[model samples]
Target chain A: MGLLSLLSGLCRWNNNDEENSAARSFILSSVLWLAFVVSLALILATKFVWPDFLGGTAWLSFGRLRPLHVNGALFGWLSMSSTGIMLYILPRLTGVRLYSERLGNLTCLLWNLLLIGASITLPLGYTQGREYAEFILPLDYLFMSILALLGYNVFKTVARMKDKAMYVSLWYFLGSLVWMPFTYMVGNNFLMDTTGLGGRGPVPGVNDAMLNWWYGHNIIGMWFSTLGLGIFYYFLPVLTKNPLYSHRLSLIGFWTLAFFYVWNGQHHLIYGPGPDWLEDVAITFSVLMLIPVFAVVYNFFKTAQGSWHLMFDNSPEHLPVRFFMIGGLAYFLTCTQGPFQALKAVNSNLHLSYWVVAHAHLAFLATFSFISMASIYYVLPRLLNTSINLRLAHWHFWLLCLGLIIFLGILHTAGIVQGAMWLVKLEEYDFVTGSALFKPAVEFIDIVRLLHPFYFTLWLGAGLMATGVMLFVVNVLLTFYKADSPGGRLRSKGA
Target chain B: MYTALILFILAGSIICLGGIYYKRSIVLGILVPGAMLLIIIAFLSTAVLPYMEKIPATDKGVPYSERALLGRQIYVREGCWYCHTQQVRPIRTDAGLGNVSQPGDYQYDYPHVLGTERTGPDLSHLGGKYEDDWHRNHLMNPRPKTPEEEGMAGKVKGSVMPPFSYLSREETEALVTYLQSLR
Candidate 1:
């Protein structure tokens, strides 16, 4: 009976008219995660240990490693995880067999390949010279193609849905499917950079800034946040066995965030070389962004109201949901602090400090960790057709949360140290090039910074984070084998 | 101090007002004070403003520092702010770039382009740190710029600053004009 139940959970969702084929989605997901782990090991090794590599090339310096790490986590890990969830999620949400299994398989294969290109070309010194748009232009074209295919499949699935509600996940899924391409095109200058879609001249910095930010911030909002939000909407209620506190609030949070999130990316540029008004606008939205963030977090937390135990020791199936919970909170904290940091006065000091890096990682990795972990918990057991070992799942949860605190805490405190020291220094004629003021800060925070400031501490934090990720990767692999429960079987026909 | 009080209260109130607040965000309500704390910090920011150093009005022409400020404008327009910081910190703090950035140096800075992220190095005190030739080489091809390769000091340090071959000589000169103007 348990075996049959497991099978139904695994294959039934994909094939009634069709077989349990989107199986490639499972392979894609596993391979993507495996690839991410392996690549991360190399990247981290280079940054932490192999102080000298690439035969003394300029591009391989640690200055560039920052972007590489971000790309790996965001594009490599987070993007694939979201796609994997969509394999099951889109079908289940839409209540229909995938429109084309072959197409789905192709898209998954091409998407990972394109990501591979981004990793290779970017590190090999081929890049577009923009922050997020670093992958050379052709790689971007490959990305856009994957998005287009995914869009087609999803639209076809939506057309077939029996459920009229278009559950919020579909709304968000479709939103991502639409918005990212638009964001990419403008940011990548897709037409102009290629076939000359628009006339070019002194590409207005403000215009480019706005466009880059619009795309950058939206990825956080429409892609990762929306997906993360959808996961919360589905899993929180299921785990707690409670009706979502208010679908009304959920809708409000969703749309408000959609508008606000895109604008907030500008906050990253405040006190920058941008104009005064631009900084003002960035600061304003940085503050205004609080609305949607609060809405999502409050609503999610509120849903767990009375069923506090559900949040406690529970089925292994729910650990990822707990991650989403904490991730939602971290998002709120990060966003709240984000606007404050954007303010001119504070920004004057905090702009180039580790504090910003801490926040950036907290915001990105927090949401990434939450959503990715939740996706794994929600789907992996089902994918493997077995219940996860609850104890192992709990270990994964603690390690991740603790590691985040260690990582983020160190960065945040280090950032403050960096910011304060900067402010205390001379800026004009008397200014000498030295880290004197900053030295005391590093010393004061030595317990926190632990050792010398700069690369070592950063590598340490990233190291702990890598360890946590390794733990998670192991747990997911172990789930491939069956648990000794009724939930272990994979066929409803009862072999 | 008020900022501390407000933050404490703000954090405390969030804990106090636990549980669902509907479409009405209790968190944003708390965030209002966070904004207030920012205003307070900005008020205290006057300390840095006074330290901004003025150009000595060069006999060669319109104080090249002003031109450097112009170059900084280009830096901003180009989204260099997205990756690099201009502000330097005080003391031996590990981050304010390797120097204690001075207030006098930024007096003329209208928008104060000190950035927050180290997607690149803090440029608070990049003045006289490089020569025209070195800056040219780095800007033309960051891929080849040596980044001082190793060690703490080099007469002509290597760097990973991107190539600005896209800019004309005048534009590049203007940029160099502005960069050299940095204290």
Candidate 2:
């Protein structure tokens, strides 16, 4: 029985139900990557407090590890898990199996290989030097091709749907599929250094800066957020066991988000060299982004009206719903902060500070990552026909929540201090000018010193988050392997 | 410039509205095309339009030398730009950094490395800030050499910069050259 179960788990493609096969493979792959990358992040957090922790190792240095951490978290953990959710959700919504389970498995295999390649290459100092779009050219091409395959698999399934009426989640999933490939191409392979695409060179000068941010922000807006929203929309009614609050509101949120998000990327350059008019345009759209944010939050709360007790409940059945509730709250805070920080006055102070880092974590970690966790919990048990340990689930949830709060709080406080220190002017003697100069009241190095304690605390928070994620991973593995054991098996009604 | 931008936005909005109105299917017909149009409008305005704008002639802007170009590649490979920013803004935090960065100054910077974060100080005007030896030594050991030194005097205090002593001498020289060429 052990050997048979192991084989069944490993060779999911051989399973008769193709959608379940593909989804289980993708989820399994995603959890392993999450474990690996979260460890990498903890290492990095420790290095911030103790720079010489892994001294003299080139691959282990902060620079190489930073990109690895970012790419691993973004592509490895988040994107793969999203693909799993999409694959799982699409068949049920459309009332048709995936077009090719074999193709889906192939994409999953290739995606893992791509991340493995990144781990090796990035550590070896091979990179394009772009943030969020940092994979080397060949890897970039591989990623695009893999994305295309995933799109083809899902789109063909959508085309063959028996149900003519599409759910709001289907709209979001399909839209993200269409947007992701183009966004990846423009951001990673094409715009900068057209040599890869058979063109002259990069977009001239600061224009490349504008293009980079446009790609960076849109990847989050178009791909990550869209995918997460699709999962959020689908699971909200499922876990809550309630009809959607308003279909019209979901549509409004979708369209408005698609409209305003692409325009708000340049707000990253608020007080920089980009033209003042461009900044103004970004700021305007950024504030307008509130419409979609409010729409999504309102829909979530209204639909979750009577089910709020489930979020507070400690039952294993309520774990998935709990994840969504916290994710919704984080989503509200993150979106509010997004428009607020995009303003010229706020950005000037917080632009490059750890405040921006905190904002990013709030959006990506607290919001989207939480949503992905919710979807996984909702889908995985049903797929495996097993139950997660309630005690373990509760520990996982609270640890992650507490860890992120502490981590973000320290980063925000340190960021404000860093920003203020940089702005504090003090009159000082200048040897070069032979006169008094208006020097910063706190030297840059002094500020770095002041943040050391915060970095250490941040590491502690990261450690807790990592511990929680590991527990989640362990719980998942237990479900797969020890299904007959106590607190392990669940006879879910449907797949 | 503003006129061109305003006209472009108006035209794009009209086309999007018309397309959505005509083709009302929620999936492929409206959502996909609507998204495509919005991204196109954004790409044209933010990236392509800026590329078409003329760079004003200035003595401050100079193309990278052959060795300097090689150094730039080395710098990129090592991911130095992850911590250090190359662009200086007109904002108060950037007061003592350097001259406010202009578009013209980066005319030859292909795939411009106007980095987002500043774990280290801005390197926009670092060309003549220190000697070649100083940079080499600094890269070898970014922390203070002697216990006596503090702040930005002979050594930077409280620096979390990782030592690059593992880099080959040639790569180190190239990276130093790239840092010096930032001016």
Candidate 3:
């Protein structure tokens, strides 16, 4: 009953003209939760180097803790934060108030409930045994409902738009909303038994893999990537005081991305048992993705042509712009690396190595997380009606950047070395003779040992990144409370 | 190939032009139907059609028993797939990992566990590679045994795998059963 009253109180806002209190609260909570989970995940990652750091606990074992970390970061952190940002942006873009802030607040509450449930359930060993789609059936249903609620709210707002022309960001936002629920259903095989559909039994093994990757890649591509790009489109112009360069280019990028990314999932199974043609199709589409990537890259860079100087202004107001610029550059690099790695030769060496891990981080952390941070910075001041601490924000940005570079640099090197050694070892063994190709100069254990120093480097980088996240959280909290104080109330930019 | 490409182009065209050309029905007519069709086609080609072609006449190998299935659950619970890949590719680097994985080999997998990493070696053909006793010893402590121990010589000396000694005996046994059933 107390919980119910608290939730009702949260939804009851006094001033509801333009400021989205519910959305702002959701974004703040999501960012804080993200920081917490990311720190825990990184600490758990250190167990790789120091196995016995906290090894004895059953629930705290690397296996259970790792999934919690992955799911927590993906769903709890990135997805929730993205949804909160979308809520804030949608009303402003449409030039209308949100359809229902009360509904939005309720959704936020339920979303947090689901996240908490997942954090508890996953550690307790209840899972469906799928990466990214690991949440059991019940939780999956809850997520679908959340998506439906969000989609309803956003579409309702769009329906009441004061502006007739659909902006590029709105298009991407709409596409993501359409894409995510279906992708989740297909990837998780949720519709199979319920509809009594044809091919209703469990998805065949190889085919399940294909379906999983399709869902996995599209989640990143359609949901996070598109949403991040949409946020970028909205914020870039606002920050730069410049119009978007080539609106046509933005449309082309969106279309190409939607068409191509779904097919790229099979690239993950390149040398696995999938049909040759399927692999070829995946590779072809992955390479074709270069079109959209280059278009988006050109659009962003050209838009920032004159406004690049703002990034160097060293003002708190410009810090978010700096993040957007750096994230845009990282997005460009990540896409380039993605297509290159999708090639069979490169994949053979890098597929299962730490190279893929590095790529995932570059996409998830460097590109999307950075963009989300910028969005928060851009929107937070407007929502709170006050500025953040410039000094602390600067510290957050540099520390994160430095940490990512070190982490990626070390992992990529380790992956290449491991891949090369594996190849050499394989070549030495004669398949027909079933004997040593040559007396192996080093064993696989030697390769494992070789990676220890790199793992230590990763730990150090993660520590630095965690510190940066804490600083960001603290700065945001202090600014928030300071603005809420009685003395600061006089300066409040209230609706 | 042509069909897939045409479908791809059609999907892209609908997504791009749907909102701009016909704003009235964009959400219900174009966006919903177009996205749904794309998903259907993707599933048809990649999953359903592939299954029709690849379904085995009879089960391959022994089906995972209840115990092994429970062990598989433990594997998933622990996130073992994060480091250890279950699929062996047909490349030189995968030569020592045993036979290249086949679709039929994973016939019983509900949510397929053909993992993507090899932080440890491929486990697709791990069955019978070593004794159950060896697995128990290795799981408890990955350090190589002394030369005085039987069959200890020439084994890989150092390993980065964390001990699962904390796992209850039943859990460990079940996990071992699942590992042995992989081949």
Name the top TM-score candidate: 2
- In angstroms, the error of model 1 at A345 is 3.4
* Model 1: per-residue Cα lDDT over B71-176, one tens digit each: 7555544445545666443323334454444333433443334444663455655768888766665555444335453332222222323445666677677677
Expressed as tens digits, the lDDT of each residue in A283-389 for candidate 2 is: 99899899989989999999989998888977777789888888889999999999999988999998888898899889889998899998888887788776777
The residue-by-residue lDDT of candidate 3 on A1-495, one tens digit each, is 433433343344323333586676578667767876876768676887887667767777787777778788888888878888888899888999888886777677778888888888887877666788877777888899988988898888888976567777887788889888888887777644322221123666677788888888878988889888888888878888789998878877776677677777889899887778778878988999999899899998888889989988797778788888888988999999999999999999899999888898889888888888888888878777778988899899889888888988998898898888887752465688897643224576778888889889999888888888778887777666655655553135432
TM-score of chain B of each: 0.54, 0.83, 0.73
Lowest lDDT sum, 10 consecutive residues, model 1 chain A, at A194-203
For residue A460, what is the lDDT in candidate 3? 89
Per-candidate TM-scores read: 0.69, 0.92, 0.90
Candidate 1 stretches with Cα past 4 Å from truth are A1-60, A194-202, A389-392, A426-457, A480-495, B1-116, B119-121, B124-127, B131-183
Off by over 4 Å in 2: A1-8, A11-17, A191-200, A427-438, A483-495, B1-4, B11-26, B145-154
Task: Estimate, for each residue in A1-495, the C-alpha lDDT of model 1 and write its tens digit.
Answer: 543543343343343323334543443354345446445545644443333344234445443444566676677677767666766777776678878876776676676677767667655545444566666678788888888988898778777766556555565566666566766765565434522111112233333444455456656766776665666566667766777787767655655554445545556655443334445645776776677677777876788777666556576655665776676677777767866787767776666566866776777778656766766777776755666667766776776677677778777776776556444433343356642232222322222233244445556656666666666765665564354234555334342
Q: Residue A395: error of model 1 in Å?
A: 3.4
Q: Which ten residues in a row have the lowest lDDT in candidate 2 chain A?
A: A191-200
Best by lDDT: 2
- The C-alpha RMSD of each candidate to the native structure, in angstroms, is 11.0, 3.7, 4.2
**TM-score attained by model 2:** 0.92
